[model samples]
Target: MMTEKQLTDALRRRDEAAFRELILRFQPITARVIFKITGDKEETPDLVQEVFVSIWEQVKNFREEASLSTWIYQLSTNKARNHLKWKKLRTGFRLSWQSEQAQPPAGMNHSLNMALEMFERKDDENAITMALQQLPHNQRTAFVLSKSEGLSNPEIAAIMKLSVSSVESLNFRARQNLVKILLPYYNNKKS
Candidate 1:
């Protein structure tokens, strides 16, 4: 297998095989990031395709200031963020398109698990998505990257071009806001 530098060098040279290898290697990760941000599995494949196209076109500008994966994370997040903006503009609300049966992440805290469980009833997976959408973009990004994608705060900070503390703050705020938004639902479900 080619090293990351070798793959990037080949891509910068406009190598078709290297591009194919790039898609094969990065597509799954790119898809996961996009899906976590957008919550739309149907849109994920197309978004992943767009990310690869961007990497192909932008490889020459890659300065190697960060690892290739970090750079790709930056790209995927930017793409997903723009997608969310366009979707909101079109729909007049932040629409979430989650799977039929959304499973809570293994690393989730007890409160978050309880919050998600409250949405497990028929066709209510959207409650989780709606609560996530209530967060600000930066907070939502930090939360999804940390909680859903299992990315480290430093990794999220790098991708977001923020300090580690900022990522932590965003995540903290996100969790607090999610609880505030979903607490009533959890209470109502129990009653």
Candidate 2:
């Protein structure tokens, strides 16, 4: 496997194979960051592709101060944030995915999104997913990066351009707000 430096040097040389290698190597983390931020599985694949394209265009600007993964996460997060902003302006970030939708592609589990946590019931999992969407974007991003993506607070802070303390605060508020919003469903599940 080529080291990150070798891959980056290849990328800087405009080597197509190196770009493909970069995509293959980083797509998992890239998808996680994009999907978690956007919270829309249907759009994630396309957004991820767009992220790679964006990366290709901006490879020359990537200073090696951070790991390649960190750079990719930063790019993916910004893309996802921009996509959400455009989506909100277009439709106010409506929750009604079923209202006017196209058929999902084959082999895609439209029922479960990429976060991929197991729940006893699909409904409960989906309910939590919906509640997550209603959170302030900072809190949701922090929570997803910390819990679902298993990134350290410092990593999340770096990706989010916030202080580590701010990331901690966001995580705290995210948990509190999720419980506040979903406590009824959680109680119902218990009983």
Candidate 3:
């Protein structure tokens, strides 16, 4: 197996094999992160491709101050955020958490019950996704990386270009916001 440094060096040199290895290694996590962040299945595949293309184009400029995975995570989060901004602009709709009734994509499984850990049912996943979408971008990113990806606060901070304390704060605020956004939905369901 190639070391990360070897892979990064190869990628910087534009080696096709290194690029393919990078995709094979990172694609699943990248897709999951993008899906969780954007809450859009249809756009995810295209967005993932865009991320790899970006990595290819930008590898030369990578300073290697952080791990390659951390750098990739940062790039993916930025891409997802930009996608949301463009989508909101194109549709002239606010990307608010107060969404109309939405359905979780088909085939949601126990594994996807990452952060909430309580969403055994599809409806619960839908509610979580909607509530997650409602958070501010930094909060949402921090929450997803911490809870869903199980990354550490320091790692998240590196990816987000924020302090560890900031990541913790974002996560705390994200949890608070998710509860506020989801409470009414669960109450209505119980009624």
Candidate with better lDDT, 1 vs 2: 1
TM-score of each: 0.80, 0.80, 0.84
lDDT by residue for model 3 (1-191), tens: 79999999999888999999999999998999999999999999999999999999999999999999999998899999999999988998656432222332221222123323434345546777866766667888899999899999999999999999989888997787677656655665687
User: Where is model 3 more than 4 Å wrong at Cα?
Assistant: 96-125
Which candidate order results from sorting by lDDT in descending order? 3, 1, 2
Model 2 weakest lDDT span, ten residues long: 99-108
lDDT of 1 by residue, 133-160 (tens): 5555677788888987898999899999
User: What do the candidate models score in CA lDDT, each in turn?
Assistant: 0.78, 0.75, 0.81
Largest lDDT belongs to which candidate? 3
Worst 10 residues of 1 by lDDT: 99-108
**CA lDDT, candidate 1, residue 63:** 97
Q: How accurate is candidate 3 locally (lDDT)?
A: 0.81
Candidate closest to the true structure, highest TM-score: 3
Task: Give the runs in model 2 whose Cα sits over 4 Å from its true position.
Answer: 93-125
Clashing residue pairs, candidate 3? none
Candidate 2 local lDDT, 51-143, one digit each (tens): 999888888998998887878888888888788878878997442232113233321233233222333445545766666765666777788
